[model samples]
Target: MNDGRRKVLKAGVAVAATLGIPFVARAQSKPVKFAALLPLTGPFAFAGNAALEAFRDATEYVNEVKGGIGGRKLELLVEDTGYDVAKGTAAFSRIVSRESPDELLFVYGDSTGLSKALAPEVARLGLPYSATSFSSELADPKTYPTIFVLGPTYSDMMAGLLGEVRRRKRAAKIALVYSNSEFGKDPIPFAKAQAEKLGMQIVAEEVTPLSMPDATALALKLKQAGPDFVIMQGYVLTVEPLLVRAAKEQGLNATFMGTYYSAELALMQRGGPATNGFVVTYHNAYWYDSLIPAVEKIKQFRASKGRSISYKTTYYMGSWFVVDVLGEAFSRAAKAGKLTRAGVVESLNNMGDYNADGLIRSMKFVNHRLPYIKLYRANVQDGRFDAITDWITVG
Candidate 1:
């Protein structure tokens, strides 16, 4: 048999041996339903489209190996949340009512607000949801439990960046700009606390909607604030160019900074010279780092499919994490002789410190969010984010 067929057959045989399910016989059975809620249309569509591609690819990978847990196929159901809270609510309702997926995977929310709105309902239905939002409020053990975040939380990323500022004794003056959303609003309290503790001056703060028609005026306004550095809480398109250009036009020499989502390769490319000397924080090690086993496998997987990994895309790693979590849950459920939603949840709860080939920090469910977030400092050089620190972890 060829290598591809042999790999699939081996995977099938291993799963069958573990679950004691007839491998070849049950391979053609109906797939277990899985749903993904992402913003395919509306404000956050850029992020949504990226995440959807990742989700689709990962699900397809699992199926290529003869289905997933219990020899059951994985059926992916996708719904567009439109980056609206009400639309998100309705889309979720439809997914639950119509598709009735066994698990929810690769959910994308714009900020803490929408995540909060949906957290209660997802838990009420006992659905296992993996999402992109990483606000610390969701980490509260009392409030949310069904939600699992796969990336570094905003709080964690901020702490890492701030720590570097302190280490370098560069806390002279700092300003803030944010999108008017749950994500934008989330860091106010934490930023206040951290800034005070670190003795960093918060010179000015500004907010604008996610899809603002005129950030040029706001960008000009930000330049007038006159701080030594500016930290932007925005996605790729919203932050890099607008703020950087304004800083230049106004002749403000403050260092530029951004959070995880805004650190994508597209931002650096589009921002051009403006992105130089700007620092942003991220969680995952650069996928281009082939030394990491899981990252290497991901590269190989893409190459095998006749596609080259692009710097503009890394959400595939997020989807890979989703599958890794599911695989852990599936293995546990199979060992226990049942593969129900509750069983999967139980397995997930008990999954401790999963490193997934050390591509990221170990994932641990603390309250409703994954507690282990690792931060990497990177600057834009030649249109890509280059890691500065070896790795930084949060409290």
Candidate 2:
């Protein structure tokens, strides 16, 4: 009787194992997918490419180190927006509907206008989004709770430049040159207000389309105004030629200041002698100095990839910041044993004081905006930007 019972038990266990019950359960793997919306093939391609590389690099590093969550590798999907509202909307729809990633790692767009348009859709889908936009409108917690910004707001960067303007005693009689797009238009009002508060008068305000070949007309107007300082805002295409040609032709002696977007080294190289002594607000710590531990790691990453760390690498820094924050949200979701859309959104809402590599001071779901601001004053000389002051932090 005992032998018969033992044989029956052994046979039952073997059958269960052979049927893929216990052993198969041990081999089961979780699935993870990450997707991003970026302007890969449009006006903002430069910034988008850098961000994309950063995300790919970081996730690759994480997977190589066996740091995936729940035994699942992080997968990434990317779509191009071209920095156009309609295009951005369509790209976002394709990813959310067709690809259907578990979470969004980075939605890279430099323009606040495009971000605003897509933020609503992201919220509608209840997906967490970490983006590179600093438009103040996106700061509202009620509006875009699932979205966060990795860079300082445009107004914050502008405020830093204004501080330098006062330090140089050019708060009065300053001319403003900006592009005619949303990126250029986003900070105009805040900058004007700050100018008034600092007793700096905006003597002349000029607009040039992002597609304009030359800024001659704007430069001529600026030269005619003869202001003590000239502050310009625009992407590289417009700002580079304007600053170079304006300084060359007008012999402009004013203290030149630029928004963060004007801090491209490529533009500075093109400006050559004209861009010397040109100061622009910078968001990230210098990528080359490697003085800080965070910068050192970024340098090591650049070298490993056979790429030189430049201001462009900060795009990677910005993108990495996005992933780190989103990772935190996902971690919270995983620990809670639920991956529902509401659960992730709640985790993002309650996020507090999370910093990735010191790139960001703090990011919280406070008022649905990450109240993080740090700015550095950098001037272009010898084909590169040299930091002129200690990093500045603003609210």
Candidate 3:
């Protein structure tokens, strides 16, 4: 060692010994970590469980397939919130308290309620967050700077659907059916404004519980409206089939449509012939689609562990996709030597037209949310939602 440097080091050690202090060398860098607060064991367990599975596999995919983030392994920290807002809030605090600010750079939230509740905290921390929700309320970069929707917001999807309606038939009469919750109510105002902008009439606004016990009442309202199209929101498989059958039986004869969540195969399979022509918007490639290179990679990801590939929900596809997107930010920031939460967000905001190997199409983020989407129609005989339109940027 150089004499000057050696003398300085010796003097530092002597000072530490005199003060009864321990001298320690610099600590090694640790793996990158992100928190996932999911609803793994409650009313939303079906969807949450699927997301959990995807995150686990995505962790593996990142560490093994993507060669780790910036040469450091990626770690996913998960918590179950039971699909309750209060439970989710506590879990969010627990995760924040536990992880070092340097490591916990992002979070994947389970629902809209939790996203709203945690908005201030997440933005204050400057850790980028994405959730299963596409609520337009969370899309504002000003109010919630660090909170980003996974894909198109519900408002964007509504605009796309409404625009398509105008294209097919100008000034189409539209009916809106949504649950009585925030998920249902969030996009209605924007949908109405966009409908009016496109010269379409909002003939009816039918509201139901998240799980409607019966569709007889709703069917009557829809039939009375005589809308050119009936768009259902805030429902998955439940109430969808019931409404379809009831509406058709009532001789309503209006086309039914929905957003991404309603684009599940289970919806078509369970709804049967009644859901044959039902349409919805989606932001990712289906696992069954052979042309996507990323879909093939999904198969390879599973086969590496000697596991057979089965049909995974879009919940799985979405959760898997976000982790990779976050990994990209982590990598970019790490390489630039500013691998902090803000650094990651800055990198992500500038990631122009990157599509994560076609998980979605080439697109740009507007207000931190990808507004590009495509339309799909349920082919009940095939038990899939076939793409009816190419990717289109909306709102």
Residues 240-332, candidate 2, lDDT per residue (tens digit)?
555656656866667677766676666565666676677777655556656656667666766787876655555666677676566666666
Tell me each candidate's TM-score: 0.83, 0.83, 0.93
Which is the winner by lDDT between candidate 1 and candidate 3? 3
**Each candidate's clash count:** 0, 3, 0
- Cα lDDT tens digits for candidate 1, 1-395: 69999999999999878787555455436556666677778867777787787677666666675257566666677778887778878887877777534444323344466778888877777676666678877666455555666666777677776776677665657787887777876766687679778998888888776755445676677667777777778554665676686677767887777787776666666666766777777666566766778777666677788886764265556656576567666657767965566766677777776766665666666564554443343345545566666666565
lDDT of each structure?
0.67, 0.67, 0.86
- In candidate 1, position 145 carries an lDDT of 59
Residue-level lDDT for 38 in candidate 1: 77
Sorted by TM-score, highest first, which candidate order results?
3, 1, 2
lDDT per residue for candidate 3 within 1-395, as digits (tens), equals 59999999999988887765322221224788998999999778988999888888888998998888877789999999998999999999999988889888898887888888898989888878989989998998998888888799999999878877877788899999998877888899988988898899999998888886789888988898899998888876787889998887888888899998898898877777889889899998788987888788987889888877989898888888888788787888888888888888888887775787788775367887899999998998888888989889887
**Candidate 1 — which pairs collide?**
none
On a 0 to 1 TM-score scale, where does candidate 3 land against the true structure? 0.93
> Which stretches of model 1 miss by more than 4 angstroms?
1-30, 99-111, 212-220, 308-312, 371-381
* Most accurate candidate by lDDT: 3
Better of 2 and 3 by lDDT: 3
Worst 10 residues of 2 by lDDT: 100-109
The segments of candidate 3 whose C-alpha lies over 4 angstroms from its true place after superposition are 1-28
